[model samples]
Target: MAQQLDNDLQFEDRFHRKFYYLRLSVTDVCNFKCTYCLPDGYKPTEKKKPSFLTLNEIERVTRAFAECGTSKVRITGGEPSLRRDYTDIIRIVAAQPGITKVATTTNGYRMEKNVKEWREAGLTHINVSVDSLDPKMFYQITGENMFHKVMSGIDAAFDAGFEQVKINTVLLKNQNSQELPKFLAWIKTRPIQLRFIELMQTGEMDLLFQKHHVSGVSIRNHLIANGWLLKINGKNDGPAQVFCHPDYMGEIGLIMPYEKDFCQSCNRLRVSAKGKLHLCLFGDHGVELRDLLSADEQRTELISRIQGGLKEKAVSHFLDAGNTGMTPNLASIGG
Candidate 1:
């Protein structure tokens, strides 16, 4: 039935990559000063504060995406839980007719305390950023001393009835690259899928990229040699290439954006917190969709704008050629 719906109202790019996943940024303000993305913490602009899409705007936009056959919506932010209406946002997106999975990428700042409410609000999957399992290294990478808290939050999510939780670890060259064994051991008995994401060069992280960028290819090779078998992705799955081991309770995933043909299987589209449609994360710029989001009656035009914008979607990101486009930092558009 879902495949039939996708066939009926497909949102496919010229390359024939059908988008069934949506990465929706609820806000761009993050509290933790992660060394890679935001080293200065979240700074507000001197000009009028940027307006984030409201609850009604979120609903309308989600409805249009659902109509276009998007089945999974991943809510992202500097830290989405920072917004007071975070749970409500989850509720609204989950309530949409065609959206089956409502997930989020969070820092787990409030997860320990509020994850129960968020789960009740209809959040299906959760990815928490745990840069390092070592307390000191975690603090060094994230500039936060809340390693224990975030760990507790992961535990709390399980207690709240979450089946499998995914942990995102940004592979830093000399930092957390050598800690894979530690991560593997932690996930061995737990239902946690540890994802090792290759750090790519954004416009703002040139020097850091040169110094600490570790290719996820190395990790993928390690997994393959260690008897882990690759798993096929579901239609609504994200870009991660997953692998599982017969002995471990958890899995491993590698997200290598710099890998060749990374964009060939692109199945997701990103929307900024301010209602701008980003065709590609490393695309030159975004097309504004806020003007069409003001009223419910404009759903047709909104969907039209989305469908029209796909024509301009590039076949691949130019990261290998050293182009990061208008994306200064991941936090600006919710990486």
Candidate 2:
């Protein structure tokens, strides 16, 4: 029952954290310029960076991670669907020897037209980013008025036979935080769990923290105060602290890295669109793997770096501690 690529290698980190989950970003390009992600008046650029990893590099790196005990892999990006051969990449990775589950986090812009293809390609899980239910508010948050279209895509995902769909909502202060209670009631009619994520200390801080960042603690307290009974089920080994209410139709998840740092139980490593292996989200440094991938270096080469970097992986992110160094943008870091 163990996840394995070929029954040869098992990788462990210095912190004794086994890398069973890996999040890989296929591209840094995004269609909508969300205020939290990019600054105002941000121009969309179409030029693809030459250093971005191809489907082949993603396959090789994924194989390496699988060899090291990565069984659950999530494809992430500015928007993973942006890749012309996105489904092809999913098929390639999902078909690997030991990969048990292949998931993706997307903006759901093109999902309606492509969910069936992705499902056929071995995509077993999905997380859609939807901040608000209102079209005007959605556009204000994401800088694009695609709320209806995105909702249609979510509908398509359900119709495509993905048993469990996850909706990721980033609750900003006065912006969409008010949607917390409403969203809880709204998602119950569906077969998906609405996960509220606490804003991480990534990208522009001045624009993100002071105005938007709402603590997960506040949200949970609000839920409890609103006559919601807490019930727990399933595994709590992942990032989100799982919660449920009997009255609600689905479930809820809170990703509070700042309030309750889960770095000690961190089980994943992230691969950026440019093929950099990031040991920690708040870590200032990363291992550049593009050169090694292009060089067709042995798996041992990449494995060696992962093993060495594990020695320096922070026990917890430095966000609250104010010790964080210059961090990469979420798109570049695969957040």
Candidate 3:
């Protein structure tokens, strides 16, 4: 453990875990603030864009990650498409030395115009967050009435011929849990994978989490009763345990963060919008890699800092055991 821990910082850490996935947040801003994620009725437009890193700075840091054997990259944000140069960032990151796949998770509001452009720029995977299909419930959870707009954006992604167009549904109690079967039926014949994510413990999220948290186990039981088959180790892009019905064209995955199932094969690290590198999802405030990258430090120095951060990653968030606390706001952390 000490041998690899002291030697390489790109992927493998002191725990002997190799990290290949990178979650890069471009903008901390989002068009919609969900009920569980934001304080009551938050509006993103009220704030100015925070100090986001330049594309060139991101390029340098991404290059450093690639040098350390980071192969998969996911571009996330409040909504990654909100950035003016998101397409350019996709092109640039996709062109990096060791980076292979460049994917984005979006709310799908601003995705209509750029799906084609982004697909052409080496974006192979797209995950759209659609928590509830009902307009009223969607608005209640996301504080946005544009449910139809997000659906259209999903269609556009398929039309644009991206390799995968997936739906990420966060299962909040009383918000969308009862609608799980209906939502599953809605995707029966579509060429998109539906993933149900358990809300992570982040920010001042405990009160809301206490009220709204639904376990993935219960959701899976409900889905199974609805006749969804558990495809053993089914196809998935990330950590979600995937499933599917005999009738559906695409699969379903459950990102069970609350299940304490992440750390064993954990393969990703996150770079927050402000340039903090998170070795674990519920990790403490990470080293500010943006400061180092912006200062024109050599790639070796940046990698060294990343190595130092990786050494501190907790074995797990230990959510129910009270070992996990809210991370920085989900929007900033690109969750």
lDDT (10s digit) by residue, model 2, range 100-216: 889999989999999999999999999999999878999998998899999999999989999778999987888888887578767777778888998776656655777688887
Per lDDT, the best of the predicted structures is 1
Off by over 4 Å in 1: 1-8
Over 224-302, each residue of candidate 1 has an lDDT whose tens digit, in order, gives 9989999999999988999999999999999998889999899999999999999988999899999999999999899
Candidate 3 local Cα displacement, residue 116, angstroms: 0.8
lDDT (Cα) of model 3: 0.78
lDDT of each: 0.92, 0.78, 0.78
Candidate 1: pairs in clash = none
Model 3 agreement with the true structure over 1-335: per-residue lDDT tens digits: 11222334446777787777899998777878787676553345436646787898889888888778777789998788878999999998988876777889998997777788999998988989898988998888888889998888888888899756888888888889888668767777776788888876666776787888888898787668878777664112468787777778778888887665576777789898778897766775577887678655678888888988777887776766755544756776788
Ranking by lDDT: 1, 2, 3
Better of 1 and 2 by lDDT: 1
Candidate 2 local lDDT, residue 213: 82
